[model samples]
Target: MLTSSNANKKRTPNRLSQHLDVLLFSRTRLEGIKQRRAMWTDKQRGIRLSQHELLCKNSCGYYGNPAWQGFCSKCWRERVRPAEARRLDTRESGEVTTPTFSKFEEKKNMEKGRRINTMRRLFWGGPSPPKQPSDSQMNALKAFQKLEPGDFTGFLKTLRSPSCQRLQSRCTAFLNTMEAYHALQVQKQSDLVQDFYQSFAEYFTSFSEAELTRTMEHVEKLIMTRLHKWVFCHDSCDDEQKDLTLQRRIRSLNWVTPQMLSVPFPEMQSTITGDPFLPAITAIIEMDAKRAPQDKLVCVSKCSQHVFEALSTSNSEPANADDFLSALVYVVLKANPPRLHSNMQYVIRFGLPQSLMAGESGYYFTNLSCAVAFIEKLDGRSLNLSPEEFEGYMRRGRAPAAASGVQAAACETRHLLDELMSRQERLDHGVDALNVQLQTWVQAVHAQIDQATSQLALVQEEVTDISLSASSSTSSDSAEIEHLILTDEHVGSPDTDC
Candidate 1:
């Protein structure tokens, strides 16, 4: 019994030593795992700090947003401030508004900003002081600001005077026109577009299928011609793009017209209609019906005509062809509200005058009569010209030398008419010489006055045809003689006799 007890006691000591060795191994593995985890944690912390350094570090200078997730501190406050204010009045929060300034006001604001900035820089360190306006520029600005309606005549004279030198030109080229004039012009065209509807009353009553067909054909030609012209001006649109754009426009026009025309204009008439397939047919019918009295001339799209048609439309009217085209696109967008573009709209709103005023590229289509009409409405006289002299003037002034040239041309015209009227010369032979002399007189006018160039081109073309036809005449023309006698007094009014 004593021997068995001794053996058991020896085995128990061996078991205790084995248990201690297993505990030591386990502790070593746990310590190694902890060290690795600590190293990994340190690496992650370094990476997060580096990423933070790269992002916008500027504080928005608002409260609590730095604690919030994804919100910019300054932006959130600004956005919320308007909304919070509306808590009292239910008005919707408006966008952060930008203040607009006139040239003089803008200059003043800029100077103020510079002063503030300069003071800051003096305290700290920054850019040099801002450049100041010249004395002439300042004086010009002051003078233009003080100009009243009654000052219009005096303004022109002053601007033209030696004192202003080139200051008037510079101010006009920069500050005289408002910054938004181009945008305003475009908006005006859009507004006046509805004035054209009255002209289409005749079409509403009688919508012919043949007329519709002709309109479609005409519109297709119009589209191709316009696109071809556009591609020439905008070289950025490559040949492939141009072809794709043309096809898209053709398809859109095809789609849009049918959709619009198919809807019955119950207001138009009881039975009149056009092809649903062609928008041009629809437009042409309207255009044909809209024609003004042939006796006197009228262009519905002209600023004067559109204004006369609807006084309120001046603000809404489209400025030019681009404005018209854009308005059509806006119309299409509002109706369907679809994701569109490419093949979704007409390349241009169709018309002779509409196409002509598109830009410099469309200048080829300019009708001199239409241009004369337009120029009359566009700024009439330079600020330097006297209102009395300007009002009575024949040509819109180019320069002092140019105006004097017109007087010279008129004097020569009087001499030529005197020779023609004296009847010392035969009507047959003298007419050619008279026509040649008249052509020379206009050519001289064209050389001196830029505006007269277009006038001369139109006049010369008609004169050449008349001179050739009249050359074979044999009758003693007493009526023409009377007209020649009257010509001396109205030499400046070239179209008066006609």
Candidate 2:
């Protein structure tokens, strides 16, 4: 009984030890899981804190982005958007509301406003508001007050005349109409401008078609000249920026050669003294000088014609559309016309649909636009040149020029080299001519020698035949005479024997 009790006590200690180990293992696992879960929660909180620090401006307690204008995305879409819609509706109903434009949009609108004011200043021929009138404006104001404003030989005088008040009033009404369209975010501004022109003709029915047409042109010039700044690329963010960017890019690419662009004309490749497309380049540059869309289009057409003429002279076959476009691209790059973006936008805004969209002028202008686009995007891949070569050329363009004295010396050397090359080319042509003449003379001499040899051989053959014939005849006669003599001898012998 004492031994059994001792054994039971030993078993109890072992059982207690095993049970304690299982409890410890379970507690450690639970602690480990809790630690892992806490770490995951802390990591997620860190991410959320970082996001909130950068994106949340109002501390809205929810995840949002700066793109939603500093408000949480959900709040912006739900609460703020509804409020904005209500405000817009109220403003549209003729309640005065201050516009809230983004920084970029505000700047754009301010610049446009400044442009329009400049035109107004010019039209008034005086300082802007809050200033005394200039001499020109004083004269116009005096004319305006007169009951019977006399003959207006000048446009400025005509604008101030009482008889022309109707015109001024109508222009103001038309401007208001255009402003309404602009506010409404109309897409087809060109079509709207067209409708305005058609309405102008109908409104001025008192004048003949020719007179009305002339008046309409005047009205158009007056309005669009003032309106251009407001409407030109109004909402488009990229238009002016693209122009400036392209201007810089093209300036960098001034070092680019016609060969690099793979101009289709061979003469353009070979000629060193002058480029064949100089006239086309000049015409393209002249496009900037004109203000009217039609005049600018005319310049484009003239440039295209020059390109076509050059292409035709260079190649035997007629130039295809692709060839024309390629040549035009080369011309535009070389010309690098000024204010290219403004000119294109003006044409797009004011040009007649029939003329600018469908006719020959339209085709030429489209090609010009394409050329400008191509120039803007020009790169090594576009020109089929290695990136290294393109970068090297661009670097050279960016490099500063040498000293004047060195440049002068270099110019002199280039002139001398050109003269030498020209003289060499002339000498080459002379040598080629001489070689052709020499070949002709050699061929004629060979022909004559052959003829003389054939004649000599025929004479020798005739002489030999005549000699053989005479010798044969002589031999036959000799044989016959010998036979006769033998016969005579035989007869004489027979007589003697008898």
lDDT of each: 0.36, 0.64
Query: Candidate 1 lDDT (Cα, whole model)?
Result: 0.36
In terms of TM-score, how similar is model 1 to the real structure? 0.18
Task: Write one digit per residue (lDDT tens) for candidate 2, span 60-106.
Answer: 55433333444443354456534655564556647555455574356
Per-residue lDDT over 1-498 for candidate 1, one digit per residue giving the tens place of the 0 to 100 score: 999999999999999999998999889989999988975564332111122321223443211112212233234334654454345233332354433446435655665577456433432234543234457645653554445533435556655665455433433332222232323332222112212212221222233433432332332232233233332223332434644443344333322221121121122222322222133222222322321111011221332233222222322343443223222332222232111221111121222222322332222112212222222232213212345644433242324333453575577667668977776557756888989999999998877797677788999999998987786463447667778878866785766766
RMSD of each: 41.6, 21.3
Candidate 1 backbone clash number: 15
- Judging by TM-score against the true structure, name the best candidate: 2
Candidate 1 segments exceeding 4 Å error: 1-139, 146-248, 258-498
Report the C-alpha displacement of residue 98, candidate 1, in angstroms.
38
Pairs that collide in candidate 2 are none
TM-scores, one per candidate: 0.18, 0.42
Judged by whole-model lDDT over C-alpha atoms, candidate 2 comes out at 0.64
